[model samples]
Target: MNLDSFEQLAQRRKTVKVLAQDSLPTADCRAVVQRVIAAAGWAPFHKICSADHRVEEQFSGIEPWRFHAIDADACRNLRSHVVHREAAGKIPAMLASADAMIMATWLPNLPAGGLGTASDNESFEPTLGNVEHIAAASAAVQSLLLAATAAGFETYWSSGGVLRSRELFDLLNIPTQQRLLGAIFLFPGNVTKSDKVEIAESKLRAERRPASQWSRWVEVKQ
Candidate 1:
């Protein structure tokens, strides 16, 4: 795509929190979701060094990040949990309104000792081992969101507290070793255009720092 077209696409992409309660017209929303996810899989990943003794001897293995798409019915099932109960009213509504919710998870490289003591793991900076994987997964999510935008879908990325609960992991049949990054709700855009008004109002009420405010060009003097 040309630079102008790319810019337009970037400008058009927006987070849609409240989706209209309408099923996507397409007979196969799953297929569309799969396509978006496939596009996401194209994101570049930094390979973990297998040759390093620290990794080869101490670490188990690295698994690629994965995505799971949950439909409304499954979302409803999640409401039974206490963790989900507090947001029960809103959570169900959001789930019911959206066509599907996609979850991104990071499967960490376990220690050779296999889930060693928390203190032992903490000292080793176990979280740091998955940094590259998380970074790649984030890029994949961005690609998925952008693809959904191009397909004329409204999308919302949410890091709801309930997502971290063990109940959700069991419900989704996600492995205990996997850590959820977040969920992306997808559905048809608001036809009444009221959502856009809300978005505009939100932007008006918030102050966003421009790139110049946070970025700097570094110069080195030898």
Candidate 2:
């Protein structure tokens, strides 16, 4: 609740990618993932839910977002599926290392007189409701990342790569109308950052703009 603690939490979170061979015990991963999800669910959102999506009862009625999680064993299976299917793009090697991952999706509010059959080509509806829904869902995704970081687990917010494909969607049984926002990976079992560990870090990770450059003071004068 304190500002200092919040600042420290923010500083601790970062994207880290590890090789497929690196992994944590399934038991530790499962427990840590549960806590991480509990933390993520606390993110604020303006709207409650979308009319089209059927959210699980266990989620406590949060409607804009839905998460499909895969454990370490599933992660390995997905990695195999990715390679076997030859899904294009920079396939993640960390799939082998990750103990768990959640494919986070947002429900898009359809326009008036429009059906909910959204496709990849249909990026988004230019409606106010849709915008708010997307933003809320995105907030939930950030919450997931922060929660994972708070657990002292290595996390990666991936752009979804093959995880966004139709094949994967059908495999996970995620509803078609929902849009994929992020693929969050969690490497548990105290995977501390080490110099010897070969990780996939962004080259621009160190380049950060100061707050003054990114923010400004505004005033309305008579």
Candidate 3:
């Protein structure tokens, strides 16, 4: 398929569970690992990450009060609370086995109020800087997923720990100078349908949301 056709097909694919532990070849798995690093290296904010935590501190210019909004302590607490809620299953072990993880970072640069504005999710007004950072990070992430799919691997991102502890970052040797973006989890082969098959219908029925509510109406400016 051409790039455009592939992109279309990829978008329709859902995030399914992977259960094949030993079926994937070692060489192919290694190739996926290399591609993940390359994708994240080319991901947005690539130039901003460094091995130094001091760099991240320097880049984040928020004042004391505003800085507390994205507090590491609070994030940790929240993540700790949710970690055990996952159903007992082999999916976690399987993911840890066949896939690799990447913790991405962004250059810390934001006006004082920019940090606090995160609490105001009710407003529909555009915040240019936040929007741009989100867009850049999203594009980079989607590119990684699409690239993995093209390579015949399945991938998903889990922000759980990356959103909470600095462990993932520290483990990855991510510099303190870089602001953590998130983590990408990947594996080879599509997850067997049986793994997800049991709950798929229930999830679809219970979790469905109206697309119109999520989609924005576009208007062209002449």
Q: Give me the candidate number with maximum TM-score.
A: 2
User: What does the lDDT read for residue 77 in candidate 3?
Assistant: 36
In the range 1-222, model 2's lDDT, one tens digit per residue, is: 799999988888887877544333454377778877877778777886655455455544656888888888888777777765565344446666688889888877765565444656136677777778778878888888888888777788888887887777888877677688888887763555565345666667789889999999999899
Q: Candidate 3: misplaced stretches above 4 Å? A: 1-4, 19-28, 36-95, 110-127, 190-222
* Tens digit per residue, CA lDDT, model 3, 1-222: 698897675664445444432333333355545665455335453233212223355434221111111122222333343335445244333333344544444433444444333232112224554455445666666666677666666555545342324443444344333444554545545444454322121235457577887898899999
RMSD of 1: 5.9
Highest-scoring model, lDDT? 2
State TM-scores per candidate. 0.74, 0.86, 0.52
Which parts of model 1 are misplaced by more than 4 Å?
Answer: 19-27, 48-63, 72-84, 116-128, 191-206
Model 1 lDDT tens row, 1-222: 899987787767776665333322323467777888778778777865222223332234333566778765555444344323655334544554565778777555666775443231122234655788678778878888888887777777777456656666677776555557778877656534453222211353247677799999999999
Task: Write out the backbone clash pairs for model 2.
Answer: 20-96, 20-97
* Cand. 1 Cα-lDDT: 0.61
Query: Which candidate would rank higher by lDDT, 1 or 2?
Result: 2
